[model samples]
Target: MSTPEVSGALAPGTHSTGAHSTVTAPPEASTFRRWTSRCGWALAVAVPLWLAVGRLLTDSAGSLTPVYAATLAPTLLVLSLVALAVPARRPSGYPSSRACGILLISWGCGIVLGFTLPDVGEGASSVLGSWAGPGFEGAAAALSNPLGIIMLFMAVLGCVVSVRHSAHGDGSGRPRDTEEDEAQGTGYFPVLDV
Candidate 1:
């Protein structure tokens, strides 16, 4: 008349190590996931430096020294957040999956907005005024450098790779078979014929 006291063991075919067996992702896939996340972390860290150096090298440009877009700050911050979200283990990846997705998206938004806004204003506060300004601070700013655009795109792409390799993808990372459950006496739902 009631569900038995089944401590709810792992379904089956999940590996036989102690205390962390619930994770079903294969060993190779797990290793690869960790690698991608690490790579993403590295790329995210480099974006600012790369952009700054590029700015510094550009000559014949006023506003000297080279100034980063407004979004650069936020993008750098979120890059860290996303890097941390990518976990070394499949089980750990589960909890931070959603956060990774969110931050990565924000990373894209920051790139687009940061590059666009400051240039628009040229010190002018109004939207129309900003766009109406001249020089790199104007509409042409976005197209000033192709490398910067590519780098920003890379940051977004890196975030995606980190998250995709995590638990957010399809069930291949984890699988539970009905037969396995029955054989283990767990039955997934744990029932018996009356």
Candidate 2:
């Protein structure tokens, strides 16, 4: 009797039984990969939450900056969406280079928007108050505020990380060949008996 052929990968000793064939799943990700993936997901989720809370606080304090939101919120929303869309794990060396690049650029733009956009009118206070003190509202102080400095640092860090991930593939050097079994002539492609 002729045996059936199965497409794709099969575990060792796996065989077709009449009409059914067993295929093994890919190997589990390493602990470090899993942890980093979770962290990425968590940070993606936290961005929106942080934005909402900041808005709420400003609204409550009667110092809401709609102009800032109009310009900066959209940028932040784009950043969050891109971050979420980025895959936590890719197929070995086939990293999400394009997505990472977009993320890096968007983050840099957001930082620039935050710094250059004018905060006019009655609600022009920084999160950490004025750099010259709570009552001082000078342009130099506004531009050199602690919050802006912190944001610049964070944006730089995020860009660096994205670049590294795109180039290094999770810092694991080159990607492994996932088709090792097939390369070794072990791919099960049994022909079905008539």
lDDT of 1 by residue, 11-129 (tens): 65464466545555433334444454455465455544443333323222234224453455446647554645654444454323333444445444444443333322223321222
Error at 92, model 2, angstroms: 5.1
Report RMSD for candidate 2: 12.0
Residue pairs with backbone atoms closer than 3 Å in model 2 (clashes): 5-190, 5-191, 6-190
Worst 10 residues of 2 by lDDT: 87-96
- Evaluated at residue 54, the lDDT of candidate 1 is 33
In model 2, state the lDDT of residue 141.
Answer: 42
Per-residue lDDT tens digits for candidate 2, residues 1-194, read: 99887566656645555456454433444554455445445544444334334434443222345544554454455544444344333433221333344444444444433333333446555433433345433553455455444544454444444433433334333332336436656554334110
Candidates' RMSD to native:
11.8, 12.0
**Deviation in angstroms for 3 in model 1?**
23
Error of 2 at 179 (Å): 12
Where model 2 places Cα greater than 4 Å from the true spot, the runs are 1-33, 48-55, 58-64, 92-118, 130-194
* lDDT measured at residue 153 in model 1 versus the true structure, 0 to 100: 63
Clashes (candidate 2): 3
Please name the candidate that would achieve the greatest TM-score relative to the true structure: 2
Candidate number of the best lDDT = 1
**Model 1 regions lying over 4 Å from their true place:** 1-13, 16-27, 30-32, 58-61, 64-70, 80-84, 88-194
The 10-residue segment with the lowest total lDDT in model 1: 120-129
